[model samples]
Target: MIEVIRSALPTRCLYSHVVVSGQTIGAVTRIRYDGPGVMVPRVFGSVFFYQPSQKINLCYGEITESATVNQFAEVIAEDLDALRDLGSGVWADTVVNPVRHVVEVGIQEW
Candidate 1:
């Protein structure tokens, strides 16, 4: 997912703050879930958007399903341009099955 956002940009780097050349493109990932260290995707693949070295700190939130997040990658692939227009936020769906990518409180972004 981070690669998708990075590759879309000319700098090929993710930043928390926007630069003169590009907009801020960041991804909040689940670094430590109920999984082992061998999982390649969970491990930070790109240092362009590195998180804190600590994971045992207090978690602000928890995603119920790692599989459901795949839906986001699919959504971005289907319409990267549309996603570019879409602002930062979380999905509205209550189901863990993740059928769609509807943003929660989407209008608030505008």
Candidate 2:
């Protein structure tokens, strides 16, 4: 499993590691984030996962900034119409604390 924590400073670049576990041998499948306010944190980033033999893409997306605190953000390959072509069995869970200006992400593989 992969875990990451990042500062939420404006204009700064942040990244988290995507962890995988279980029968599946791939990269991140989905991403979920939460913050103090009702709105999701505004962060721009992407995640990539690869198999043992060859490098491949599993799932990725861009997160826009939030104007309010009531919004939450999540990106699932199966949920997105454009990402249906991507693989399955892996996903990410994240939390953003606006007050603390930090983000935490957890990746799981099934």
Output the number of the TM-score-best candidate.
1
Worst 10 residues of 2 by lDDT: 1-10
Runs of candidate 1 exceeding 4 Å displacement? 1-21, 29-49, 52-76, 87-110
Backbone clashes, each candidate:
0, 11
Model 2, span 39-100: residue lDDT tens: 33322222222223222122333333223222223345454543422222122322222122
lDDT of candidate 2 at residue 20, scale 0 to 100: 37
lDDT of each: 0.26, 0.28
Output the lDDT of residue 22, model 2: 18
Across 1-110, the per-residue lDDT of candidate 1 in tens digits comes to 33343333332211122222122224333442332222222211111222342111111122222321111122223444444443122121212233444233111100
Runs with alpha carbons beyond 4 Å of true place in candidate 2: 1-13, 16-46, 49-75, 78-100
